[model samples]
Target: MKAVAGRMKRWRNSLRLRLLAGTLVWIVVAVLAAGWGLSSLFNKHVSRQFDAELGTHLDQLAANLVFDEAQTLRLRAPLSDPRLARPLSGLYWQVDRMGAAGEPETVALLRSRSLWDAVLAVPPDALADGEMHVHHVRGPNDEPLRMIEQVLRPAEYPDQALRLIVAATEDLISEPVARFNDLLGFALGALSLGLIGAVVVQVRTAWMPLERLREGLAQVHDGRNAAIEGRFPSEIQPLVDEFNGVLARNAEIVVRARTQAGNLAHAIKTPLAVLANAANRDDSALARVVVEQVALAQLQVDHHLARARAAAAVQIPGQRTAIRPVMEALVRVMERVHVERGVQITVGDFPETTAFRGETQDLQEMLGNLLDNAYKWASSRVDVKVAARNGDLVVTVEDDGRGLDASVREIVLERGVRTDEQRPGSGLGLAIVRDLALLYGGDIALDASPRGGLRASLRLPRA
Candidate 1:
């Protein structure tokens, strides 16, 4: 059931499927309507032709009708149609004397040989002199027939009235109509197939630009290109232009924000440095307190500035930084900074293509903090491992010193929370890393490392 619903959702979201389905429905309806209309028209035409032929036969029989000297009715000349003389040929003509009640009396009937051993039973209807009426009736052998009849009266014998009827089996109309319908069905079926093929071609051609646009966006998203690139039809060109404008605006905003953050940092730190210098010259208790507070203010400024920079950078597009190069550079720097401790940092094997889908500086800041914290806690060695899992880049920094308690693991990630005051740090390292990871839609966690020290694991988007 879930699989069926998934397919339904996918189909609903697909433009190609919607277009094809809509076009197919219209095609089927049009083809069926055309077939019905054409068949109806052909049936009507054959019926009119069949009735006209019967009318002509009736006129011939009427003109040849006469009376003998004994006042008995007969045909002076036989009908020109050969079917009239052929027994049970499905074509026949008859003449009947009307009784006083205006009904035809079969006792005084004269009929063609085609009516051999049977009679045409045309239903009673009021007919005017020389005016014909048509009917569907049964003839010899119970064959369905189309019939036409006329009433006539001689001038010499005005009292005597007669009815003349001409009929043929309904096959005259149905047979030709059936053959026409067969031909029409084949022709219409072929036409429907051709129309459907043309519709498919049209849909593919129309949607080609959209497919190309999607690919262009993918390339931009993957950071291979800064913006969508392709020649598009006029219909889609405006959308492409607008999207590229958005990307340009986003980059400008990030650059402007970083510049302002840097300027604000400089503006605030200069005043704080001046205060510290002034307070250091005096050895009073008030001066010492002022120095301590100035140092705290400086730390807060730096942390906020870093956060502001990362927040702006996170919004910029096409930002992919390779993990190995950044990790290697940070490791070198950390080794130089902690050279006296004799702590060695070893990076695990990782593919050169492994990368973070974020800015280079942000990755540097996050990894630098992790590595520095690991090096400080390690007795002799620090280990760095990187892996890609479930569309995330997971980096683990472990130290081989005493590990932190489970209670303090989450506590240390909070801002300004230091486990050891002698560590000589603001205690914002893990906190800053956590904030930066969160800005990039990732997370950081602390665990007991297999190396018997703290394990700082970071999960970030993999590019």
Candidate 2:
């Protein structure tokens, strides 16, 4: 129920739904308006028929009423005229007269017995000759009647006026029009129901492509597929095609990255073996010199390996990770490594600085390299900091110890090019760090820290 209610709410808030519902309502309204207009027109036509028939009856009644020279009024028609005897039928007639003549002729002219005792109600004011008008009358059954009345004077006695009324029950005049109205209402209802059904079908048909799109996305998210391909409606095919293109490109890049890692491994290992062999040889002073050369070459190989490994750890655009945990883990690992040396490394406090746009392990490895370099050379302490600056992950590591030669400043970052000949190390620390930075699509530079020691700054891309 809740889900259905939510769906209804969403539909109600949607512009498309509003348009559909508005259209259906307008259609129903139009039907009702047309029905009302047409019903009124048809009712007028029915009333005209009644009026025409009544007019004919009035003419007949007028012809029948004639006054002799004595001004005596008499009805020539029988009370049983076929028109008047029809019960529950539509037609009626009545005639009224004042005294006419003979024996003071206090007799009535004519009347429909349908009125029972009641007389037709006519205007009190005199009517001109042939001036047709309408009046209300009552039947003997007491039902309402609409009488079309006319006043007439015979040709011989023009002063003696007569009222001739012809009428039919209002029900007779209105029945067909009422039936038309009922049918019109039923038709509007049926049309509204049909329109609602069509609206539902239209909405489902229109959004079917979107549903398919969501299912395609779900397949990719579940790792069951790397790309989407299906027949889509023409309007939405472009969007699905673009998303498929992205997925295809990402899949291609992943394959290339894997291949590059393997090739980089092969490229470094052969040279590394040669270097190890050369470094193991001990023959002359120059041979001892060859060991230094070979040791440096091996350092370059190791740096290449680290670079190849870092390549696989890179994140795509718009990706992000929590940095503090990776940083803390590295710090703990470094502290554990230097436990025997009594080195106290203090990481700066930046509590809310967690999010960064890079792979977690890559950042941790980069920090590890820079801090390890500091740990090796620092006489007392090393300080590390991380913060975001101008769309970069800005990392700074500082140590208070002897700095390197200004001339060989850049050479320190070259693969295996250590400034100190007697440091007795592989000399690939800075080089490996540089390669890792480059592999992760970032950069690192060495400079004098504010504490008069080596400061290394690493900048990785932001999301």
Candidate 3:
């Protein structure tokens, strides 16, 4: 259920989904409108044909009517239609005599056998001679019918005027129209489904290039490629080219920054070296102060230079350094350097595939400081572990030495703050490590190690 909700949210946020839904809605409305229009037209046409049939019958009845020598009206021959002879057959005709002038009464004259001793209840309307009118009337069986009637004066008997009507049950028109409507509904329903299917296919096909662009960007993010790769449609190619241009500009900026940092370092170190030499040549109180200040200035220069280099390296994309190899190399060097101390360096649970998303030098700088500090303080053993967690690569270096007070842990991370002044160090090791980690969008923390010394936990971006 949660997965379904998540998919629903994604669908609501997607442009393709919105477009397809809107198109389908329009299709349904259009199909319904067209279906209604066709049904109405078909019904109208059927009604006209039914009225025409009734008109033909009325004409036939008029042609057949005659008057005997007694001046009484009669049909010379029966209607040619067989249904007209059957009682209550839903098809019938009737004749009536209109009252003479100044009279409002009408009298029944003759009717088809289908009337079955019953009369058609037509409305009493004044119809002109030879003019026809249509109406809804009750038939012999009390069924609804559509009737067409005409009034005329017989040529053989000018004194007598006759009204003629022919009708059929309303179902004759309704049944065919209803059947046609059902068929039209089914056809439109099928057409709607087909259109929806086509829309889905079209939307997916039209958006396929965007999907490829996304995959290409992912590859660049993961350090697999320097820029977007592959051919694209004309509409999308410009976007790809613009993005590549941005990446190129960013790369140029990072390179220039690194070069400037290096030049500044070299330019400062030369004068600092000259001051150190002059202070060594004279052994006075002023010389001692000059040496102390020169050392202080050198520390500051090294600190800022490392920061500047790390800041520039962080902006350089597509940099990945394998965790296992770097850690192994660092351990070998630390073990060799601290061999006389009898400190044993061991690796634990390090994944070969885990990688840091930064420069190799930056990774080595952070890990190197942490491991060297651990080795320097440890009495017998140091352990290093590397793992990936929460989209970060965590490298923990623990040593079996006297751990610092919990209150001093945060202070030790500050520049020029050392827990033990007796230790031969400028106190920038942990500070540099923290700065480098942070520059790479990562962090470093110091905690009490379970092995009895400090634990330096370094969290860096993972690739």
Candidate 4:
């Protein structure tokens, strides 16, 4: 579960997810708002136009309602009027008159049965006396209605008033508006999705390099590699360049530190040794004790200097060194070291395919130290094998000399630890090898060898 949580955090914290999510929300809000505003404006404009056209129709109706030689109202209309025959025709008008002031209205004329028997109901807030206003009303057929009103006055009867209402079913006026709304809604939705998709693509493509950079940093942090490389986005390139710069600076510092320690060791060793010689002179018991203490101090300095030197050696990017050649060289050195003791050293067969990764010098230092310990302690034959298994390189050395007691082996690889009686050396060689293995993200351990001798195995990762 912790592993799952870690992976989830890794994904969510990525720049691509943040950028794409932010952009998608931004576009959705902006585009949807625009679409809504457009839809509203379309409705207002179309309603105004329908009202104006209906008013014109009402004017024509009023003009035609003249007395035809008989003082009675009559409608004048052309038989060939194109608007009358249109299916779902948008044009409609009505006339309403009162017999006297304060009387109820009576319908005088109507152009279509779309109103059925119901009257056009205007908004209660509509102004009287030559005011034009928009309204949504119920029509004769019980369908929705859009309508307007204009009071028509006959020239002959100016004192009397006639109401001229021009109407078009809101269904007609609204049909196109509805269709436009649908089209606009779909367009907006599609555009918003496309914008979101574009944002995702942009963020994903842009942030990919950063992801690789993070992984590379992790590898370096884990001591698996020394450097990283690749092109980066403009925004993050400086960080990458800075990181590389830091690595270079650190390498240089390590080198300088190693050189300074070596110099200090060189300057201190001779004087200290001369002082020791004087102290070790005959009949100088207290001075001899002082010399032993001085020797121990000198030994500590030497070990620290060795560690600094090992750390100073650096490798640049894309450079790999195999372990076989270094192993062979160390074996030759060990043979010379143990030749007087008549110890037989046998190195295992490692194919070219089986290789450990590191600098030749560094691998040599680590392997040389381990084998030197084995040769010093072994009575007869010493066996060594270096091989690759499961992305790891295994180096095992065994000796037929007296095997290490479990308690002694435990302290052998510990830093600053030495044997109880002070063996030949300060017991720092194995410690140095341990430190080097840790630097490469590897480990070393001691156990019983197959030949009833001590076994030393180092497991290192393949680059």
Candidate 5:
């Protein structure tokens, strides 16, 4: 469930997905609109043709009409359509005589044989002679129909006018329209699928350049390249150029800061050396005071300068330092420095691939302090282990010597705080390690070791 939620969040945040979703919505709406419009047009066209067929039949029936000597109207020749000749065949025609003055009834004179004994009953209306009218009406079988009617006076009997109607079932038009709509729906469905496929291809093609840009940035982050590289589409090339420019500016700033820190260190160390030499040549209390203050000033300068260098190094991108070599080198040096004590420095399970994400100098400085403290307090064994966990590198230094009390573990991390006053050296090792770790977004912790000694665990960014 968490994985599904993570994927959903990523999709919601993706530009390509949002663009594709919006495009598909518009495509659906457009397809529906077009389908509706085309179906309407087709229905209108089919209806017109159906009505024209009825109109032709009406015209034929009117032309074939004849009046007998008694003035009774009849068809001289039957309609050519076979459906009109069959009883209840859904096609029919009828004739009606105009009623005399003050008469409200119309007299039915003749009708097509298809009507059997029934008639096509049209609604009564004041229709002009020679004019055609159309309506939806009920036929012989009470079935729905499209009826066309006309009123006319025959040339043989100019004063006697007759009403004529021809009708066919409404199914003739409805069935065709329904079938057309079904076929249209199928065709449009296929077209929609094709369009959706085209949209998917288009979106992927358009986003390819961004994918390449992401890969290039990853290369830079992994210390494989100093800046983004490779050709890009014209639209995305400008962004690539701007990003490289920012990286260049950042590199320049880091170089300038490093150079300034170096110059400051050189400038201050010379003045401090002269003061120390001048104090040693004199024996007065004033010279001794100057000597001690100069020493303290030198220490302060060194401490802040180390911090400045670490701060600057953290800002430089793509820095990776292998932990194994640094730990091995520190162990060799510390073993030789404490040769008389016979301290057996042993490295624990430290993978060669485990690396710090900062400068080599900073990693060395932080680990050097921790290992040195462990070596100083160790009886016969010192152990150092380096491992990576949760985007951070952890280095554990353990010594088999008397460990500090639990209450003073936190206090020792303070500046100038020593666990034993008898121990020879300034009490700034752990404090310097803490300051440097914090500068690089890392931390150092002190704990009692399982080996009955101190354990200094340093956590820093991993590459």
Candidate 6:
């Protein structure tokens, strides 16, 4: 049931299916209506022609009909149609004499050879003199017949009245009508198929621009292009223009935020340096406290500035940087900075094509913090590895120093929390790394390393 519902949901969500379904329904309805209307009209026309032929024969029989002096009815001249003389031919004529003015019963006075000892069992009805009436009745062999009859009073024998009838099998009318309906059905079926094909082509042609637009957007989103590019139809051009405009504005906003953060950092660092120098001139307790507070203020400023820069930069699209080169460069910088500690930084083999889907600067900031901590804490060596996994770039850095206890691992990731005060650095390295990773829709995790020190693993979106 869930699978059926899912299929139904997908069909409802498709524009092509909706268009095709609606067009096909209308085509079926129109074809059916046309077939019915054409068939009905053809049947009516053939029926009228059939009735006219019978009526003409009836008129000929009436004009030639007369009674001799013996009061016997006879036709002065025979009908022109040859079927009237052939036995059970399907066309026949008869003459009958009425017993009384209002009597329904009639005696057959004469009939064509086509009757072949059989009679047309026409229903009794009030037939006015010289006026023809039509009916459907049984003829020879119980075959259905369409009949026309007229009652007439002869001038030579005014007291004697006669009825004349001409009939033919109903197949004359039915056969042609059946043939026409079959042909009409076949023609309409072909037309319906042609129309459906036309609808399919029109739908696909009309949606081609949308398909192209989707591909273009995917390129932009996957960081292969900075903006969508293509000439679209007028109907979709406005949407493309609006989307490109939004991307441009986003990049501008990111740049503006980074510039503001940099300006604020520069404005605050000078005063902090002066305060630190003044406090260093005295060895009193108050001087030491002042120096410690100034240093803490500087770290807070740096932390917030990094957070602001990363948060703003992450909002822009189409940024990608190779992982191997960035990690290699950061490792060299870390080795040089911690040269006195003799910490050996080793990078593992990694694919050069492995890339992070974010700004190069942001990637450097996050990796720099992680590697700096590992280098500072390592006893002898630090190991860094980069790999692409599950559409993400995973970077792991481990050190050979004493690893943190499980209880303090999570604590050290918090802002300004130091595991050991003797370590010559602010305790915001892992916290800053955590904040930067989260800004890029990524994260950093710390665990016990096989090298015996803390292992920091960073996961970011792969380009």
User: Largest lDDT belongs to which candidate?
Assistant: 1
Residues 1-463, candidate 3: write the lDDT tens digits: 9999999999999998899989998998999899989999999999999999998999899999988989777899999999999989999999887787623334468989998788877787877778899999887777899999898887877777778889999999999999999999999999999999999999999999999999999878877788999999999999999999999999899899899889999899999999999999999999999998999899889888888888987776688898888888988898788889999888887657889888888888889999999988998998888888988888888999999889999999999898888887889989999999999889988889898899989999998
Q: Considering lDDT, where higher is better, how would the candidates rank from best to worst?
A: 1, 3, 6, 5, 4, 2
Residue 228's lDDT within candidate 1 is: 91
Clash pairs of candidate 2? 71-100, 72-100, 72-101, 114-139, 114-140, 115-140
Show model 6 residue runs off by greater than 4 Å.
Answer: 1-7, 98-107, 139-142, 158-161, 277-296, 324-354, 364-462
Question: For all candidates, what are the clash counts?
Answer: 0, 6, 0, 1, 0, 0
- List RMSD in Å for every model shown: 4.2, 11.8, 4.6, 6.3, 4.6, 5.0
Q: Please provide, for model 2 over 1-463, each residue's C-alpha lDDT reduced to its tens digit, 9 standing for 90 to 100.
A: 9999999999989876787778777877887788788888889999888788777777777767766667676657744447576554545776766334311113336666544445555545456667888877666566778878666767786766666778878887778888888887788778778877888788778877878888877655433455665889888888888987886677578658867776876787677677667757757787777776766666565566566556654523334667778888888998998777677888877656456555565666677778888888887889888777875677888888887666777888887576677754666777777777787667887888777888888887654
Query: Which residues of candidate 5, in runs, are more than 4 Å off?
Result: 1-12, 87-89, 96-134, 137-144, 151-163, 274-295, 331-351, 372-431, 434-459
Worst 10 residues of 1 by lDDT: 100-109
lDDT per residue (tens digit) for residues 1-463 in model 4: 9999997898799666666667777898899789889988998898777666676766667667775666666677632336544544554556666345523265555444434445565443424556666566766566676777766557877766666676666776678998999999898888887887777787777767878898888677434567767777788889988989989888777667867888899898888888888887855778978798888878777666656665564333332567767777888888887788888888888786555555666677678888888887888888998877777888998998778889888788976676645446667778888887777668899999879888999987665
> Which pairs in model 3 have colliding backbones?
none
lDDT (Cα atoms) of all candidates against the true structure: 0.91, 0.71, 0.89, 0.73, 0.86, 0.87
Give me the displacement of residue 303 in model 3, in angstroms: 3.6
Which of candidates 3 and 4 reaches a greater lDDT? 3
- The local distance difference test score of model 4 is 0.73
Measured with C-alpha atoms, the lDDT of residue 170 in candidate 5 is 93
| Model 3 spans > 4 angstroms off | 1-9, 69-74, 86-89, 96-110, 113-144, 149-163, 277-296, 333-351, 369-434, 443-459
Q: How well does each candidate superpose onto the true structure, as a TM-score?
A: 0.80, 0.51, 0.77, 0.66, 0.77, 0.75
Residue-level lDDT tens digits of model 1 in 344-390? 88888999999998889889989999998988889999988999999
In model 6, residue pairs whose N, Cα or C atoms come closer than 3 Å (at least 3 residues apart or on different chains), thus clashing, are: none
Better of 2 and 6 by lDDT: 6
| Position 282, candidate 1: lDDT | 100
- N/CA/C clash count, model 1: 0
